[model samples]
Target: MSRVKESIEVDVPVRTAYDQWTQFESFPQFMDGVERIEQRTDKLTHWVTKISGVKREFDAEITEQIPDAKVAWVTVAGEGEQSGLVTFQPIDPTHTQVTLMMDFDPEGMAENIGDKLGFVDRQVKGDLKRFKHFIEDRGTATGQWRGQV
Candidate 1:
């Protein structure tokens, strides 16, 4: 098991940040390794990702959520076993600090090699940076899903 974490502060509201994060399908706009995300249900999501030329598919179940605050999820099926959380902390009326944390294990050969070489860490940082740019450019989220499980 390996843990990779990164964070970035976005010039947006807490709710804005949270809402944007909820749009799983929009992840590809910032998340480099992600190819697509399907919001299957209120608490379920399917993901297809290609990283370092290796692709994998997975499903995750939202474990916990707090409006305008945080979202957490755990992978339930796929080639990866992991869990992660994204939290939105308001710095001001128009600024929010987004923090992301994930715990995962490298599954196949490519992932294992990539992880041991710090490739995964660098990618995570890159992803966060992209996310910053993405949210900043957008100014507001596309939509929000606030329903409970």
Candidate 2:
């Protein structure tokens, strides 16, 4: 397994940032390589992603979720073994620090090589940067899910 951690500061409130993240289907707007995300249930989602010419589909279950604080998930059944957590910290009323940590296992030669070469790390960083822009530009969440788990 390989791990990647990245963080960014967004010009938005913690609640705003966290709420936007709960809109799983909107991830493709800022997350590179993500083709689509379908919220199957409050705690489950289906993901379709393409990276480096490889396309994968997976089902992820939200293992833990705390509104305005963190969200964690793991692949329940999929083409890959992966899990991740994202946290939101309020710096002030108008600033939020968002962090993402992910763990994944490379399946084959291509994936193994890419993982070793820091491909995943770079991708995560880029995705977070895009997310910063996305939320800051909107200045409001598309939706909110405040249920606890």
Candidate 3:
């Protein structure tokens, strides 16, 4: 398994950042390689991704969630095995620090090589940067789910 941890500061409140994150379907707007995400339920999400010409589909179950704080999930059924956590920290009334941590098993030769070359780390970092722009530009969450998991 390989692990990646990345963080970015966005010009938004913790609640704004956290609420925007809950809208899973909007991930494609900022998350590279993520073609689509479907929120099957409050605790389940289906994902479609294509990276370096490889396409994959997966289901991830939210293991923990706390509004304006953090969200965690593990793959339940998928083309890959992975788990991740995202946390939001309030830097101030109008700034938030968002961090993401992921653990994944690289499948096959190409994935293994990419992982070793730090591809995943770069991807996560880029995604967080895009997310910063996405949320800061919007200045409000597209949607929000406040339910506990």
Candidate 4:
């Protein structure tokens, strides 16, 4: 198992950031490798991604979610499995500290090569940077799913 954690400060309200994150289908807009994210339910999601020329799909179950604070998830089932958490810490009313951690499988040669080359870490940081720009500039969410888990 490998874990990568990255954090960024977004110039947006905590709720605004958290709410935007909840808008799962819009993830592809800022999340670089995410080809699509389908919200199966409030606590479950299907994610398809392509990175370093490798494409994989996964299902994640949200284990815990606290509005404006944190969202944690574990892999339910998929081609590539992982567990991770995303926490939102309020630095101020207009700023939030966003952190993400993930543990996943490096399946074979391609996956291992990509991991050894620091491709994953760089990708995570790039995604966070894009997300920062996305939320700070646009206060409205792309879409939202408010059904209870």
Where model 1 places Cα greater than 4 Å from the true spot, the runs are none
Cα TM-score of candidate 1: 0.94
C-alpha local distance difference test of each model: 0.88, 0.96, 0.96, 0.85
- For each predicted model, how many residue pairs clash, with residues at least 3 apart or on different chains? 0, 0, 0, 0
Model 2 worst lDDT window (10 residues): 140-149
lDDT of 3 by residue, 1-149 (tens): 89999999999999999999999999999999999999998899999999999999999999999999999999999799999999999999999999999999999999999999999999999999999999999999999999988
Report the C-alpha lDDT of model 4 over 7-65, residue by residue, as the tens digit. 99998888888888888788899998899999887788999998767788989999988
User: Model 4 — TM-score against the truth?
Assistant: 0.92
Candidate 2, RMSD to the unseen true structure: 0.6
Q: Is candidate 1 or candidate 3 better by TM-score?
A: 3
Write candidate 2's Cα lDDT for 28-146 as tens digits: 99999999999999999999999999999999999999999999999999899999999999999999999999999999999999999999999999999999999999999999999
**What TM-score, to 2 decimals, does candidate 3 have?**
0.99
What is residue 53's positional error in candidate 3, in angstroms? 0.6
Q: Which stretches of candidate 2 lie over 4 Å from their true place?
A: none
Question: Which residue pairs collide in model 2, if any?
Answer: none
Pairs in steric clash, model 4: none
